[model samples]
Target: MRNPLADKVVNIKPSGIRKFFDVVSEMQDAISLGVGEPDFDTPWHIRDEGIYSLEKGRTFYTSNAGLKDLKIEICNYLNRSQGIDYHYNNEVIVTVGGSEAIDIALRAMIDGGEEVLIPQPSYVSYEPCTILANAVPVIIELKAENEFRLMPEELLEAITEKTKILILPFPNNPTGAIMEREDLEKIAKIVIEKDLFVISDEIYAELTYKEKHISIASLPGMKERTILINGFSKAYAMTGWRLGYACGPKEIMEQMIKIHQFAIMCAPTTSQYAAVEALKNGDADVAQMREAYNQRRRYLLHSFKEMGVECFEPFGAFYVFPSIKEFGMTSEEFANRFLQEEKVAVVPGTAFGDCGEGFLRISYAYSLENLKVAIGRLKNFVDKLRKEQGR
Candidate 1:
């Protein structure tokens, strides 16, 4: 019998984050800081809305584009939250999650062998999704010195004639790097000059510590050329809901919706009703949660300082990437050793991208008590390594 798997699907690597998560699950006393999920429950009101919808027998499938009410709420939320305007009818698409939104957007826009510029240490899905879309994924290694923000020069250097899309993963996963307004302005200029489009994944938008998350779509000349992907998973603690949306040019959105129509039918009808509630009444809840995450974020930074571990301060997202290079171990080795020695699980930075070597991603999503214990273990691990190296 002949093997029948497509090589493209066969070649995709399983997510590295999940590999360690599976390992940690078997350890009885292990404390996991590896998963990027928020620890908070869905806000009571949002959950209540879902219950109300189900109780009212609103379980039917929504339109392929999702509920119009939800789309309107999404547009209003984006405009109110980010100063960007989008038409609910034509410019926005509701999908299974930000993940599906990403998949559809790439499928809609990418042609065979088109080049997509992806900055390293980003969300793990982008590269694989691009490959499945039949596009070539070109990784630009962002640096620790720039706080992992993509330099315009780097963008320019990577662009070739085949370049068609850029995946902007800011308030980045693992590293927690955020691109500021001015930083985006620089890259926006390059994108316009080069006639490139962008897929901006701002799923971590509301989790910024001291800064407001800036969307590249809000920049001049960008609204028409950017596909902005966001959802409730991060901000509203609705990961299980699997709801997200994409807003962008009508032409592109039409293509995305076509793919979504055949592929998804629509996002969950129950989830859409609940999301409308999230957008309408969940702002205060988001603020409260953000403040809580901010406290945890600061504590992690201070703890790293006290331990003398070298890591750049992260202002956005729920994870921090700390360098383990001083210990003279590969990230995987350090993480495995830490888990064995301390029963604390952290994702090796290589999980994000190859450039993430010598780093580890520690999520602050756990409670302060759990994090404190985890950090105590981590400090001990690092200190022992220090002693061994005489550093």
Candidate 2:
């Protein structure tokens, strides 16, 4: 019997993060920092709104672009917080999550064989989404010296006549590297010079530490060329709610909305209601969670230094990328052995991209007590390895 799956579907690998998660799941007493979700529960008020909506029988599909109220709230939220604005009536399309928004945007923008430039050690979705959309994902390896930030020179070097989009995964996953206004301006100049479109994933926009996140779309002349992706998952502690949105020029948004409409019908209606309340009243919860994660970030950095693990200091997001090169093991080998010896699960850096080899991503989303325990186990594991190798 012939397998009926499309060639593109068969060619892509499963998400590297999920593969390790499944392994960790079977291990009893494993402390996992591999999954990128907040430890905090969704705030009570947001949950209440969802319950309130369900009780009022708001279960049917929403308008394909989502409810006007939610879109309006999203527009206001982005404008006020990130200084990026979109027309609620024409520019925003709410989707199942940022994941869906990425998929829809790629499908809408890329024709077959078009090229999408993606910076490495980024979230895993960008490359696969581009491939699934029949676009070539041109991977640009970001350097650790620049704190894994995408350099304009690197970006310019990757551009070709076939290039149609650039996936800006800043305030990045795994590395936690963010591009500030100056950093973005360099890239923006190239975008304008080269006539490239941008899919800016700002899912971690609220979690930046050193400086407030600057949306690429907020730069002069870039709004029309950028698709901004954000959601309540990280900011509002609403990962399970599966709500996200994409905003861009009306023409691009209209095309994305078509893909979303045929594929998802609409994002969950209850989630849309909850998202409205989140956008309106969830600022305090976001601030509280950011402070908590920051504390954990500080603790983890201190512990890693004490343990002699060389790491790039992360200025954003809740994850730390530490080089395990001195340990004389591949990222996967270190991760597997660390799990076996210490029962603590951190993601192998290679799971993010090829450039992530010799590093590990430790998420600070756990409680302080758990982090202390994990660090203690990590200390022991490092010591044992040192003793065995006579280091």
Candidate 3:
């Protein structure tokens, strides 16, 4: 038989997070902090809307761009939340999820051999999607001292004649760092001068704990050059709904819509109707969930401090990147032993990127009760490691 696998697909690594997730799934006693999913159920009203849509027999496919009303709601939500204006008819396309938006945006924009700037310890999809799009993935290694935020100097240094798209994974995954407006202004100036485009994944925008989240597209001279991708997954706890949308200049969005039309046809019809409800009426529910996550986040940080673990304070998203460098073990080694000895599952930082080697990404999306139990196990594990090293 012939070797049928494409080299590009074959060479791509499977997600490291999923590997641990699968193992933890089978270990009935294990508790997992590896996956980035929210623990909250989709708010009842949103689910009720989906049920209503089905009861009305609204299961047919929407337009390739999406239901006209959902597109308008997406624009309205963006304008209401971030003050960015986009035309619903041309600038937006609903996608299967934010992951699909990321994929199609890269495919639509890159013809081949272009360089895509990706910051490390990011969501796992960017690098692989760039490769699949036939583009070069240039990684900008984010530093822990800067709280994992991408600095302007780093972005400037990564640009080249061939650099085309920059994937800004803020309110970042695995690291939970967010870029403030001042930080984004510097980057926006650089991007404008360099004449490069951006794919800003703001999926965790509403989950930000600091001041309100800002979209890079709202910055001067940026809206035309950036594709903003977000979805209901994090904010409304609608992960399983698998609905997301992308907004950009109509030129790029048209190409993306073309790809989405042929490939996905449309996002789930029931989910789209539910997301409309989520956008229009789910604010209080989101605020409540955000507060709960914030509480859990604080508890974990306090627990880490008492255990003498070094972790930077993350103001956005539900994960914490804690340094495990003092343990005299690789992140994988520490995580493996922790899982086996403590029966607690947390992701090795290197799962996101090589720069994540000395850290571990622990998600706080789980409940406070579960987190308390997990931290108790973590404290014992840390103390045991310190004693073994005679520290």
Prediction 3 TM-score vs. true: 0.99
Q: Taking the tens digit of each residue's C-alpha lDDT, what string does model 3 give over 185-275?
A: 9999999999999999999999998889999999989999999999999999999999999999999998998899899999999999999
Q: Could you give candidate 2's per-residue lDDT for residues 172-227 as a string of tens digits? A: 99898889899999999999999999999999999998989999899999999999
Better of 1 and 3 by lDDT: 3
Ranking by lDDT: 3, 1, 2
Number of the top lDDT candidate: 3
lDDT of 2 at 45: 97
Give the Å error, residue 315, model 2: 1.0
The 10 consecutive residues of candidate 3 with the worst lDDT sum are 20-29
Task: State each model's C-alpha RMSD to the native.
Answer: 0.8, 0.9, 0.6
Candidate 2 ranges with C-alpha deviation above 4 Å? none
Error of 2 at 203 (Å): 0.3
RMSD of 1: 0.8
TM-score of each: 0.99, 0.98, 0.99
Model 2: residue 34 alpha-carbon error in angstroms: 0.4
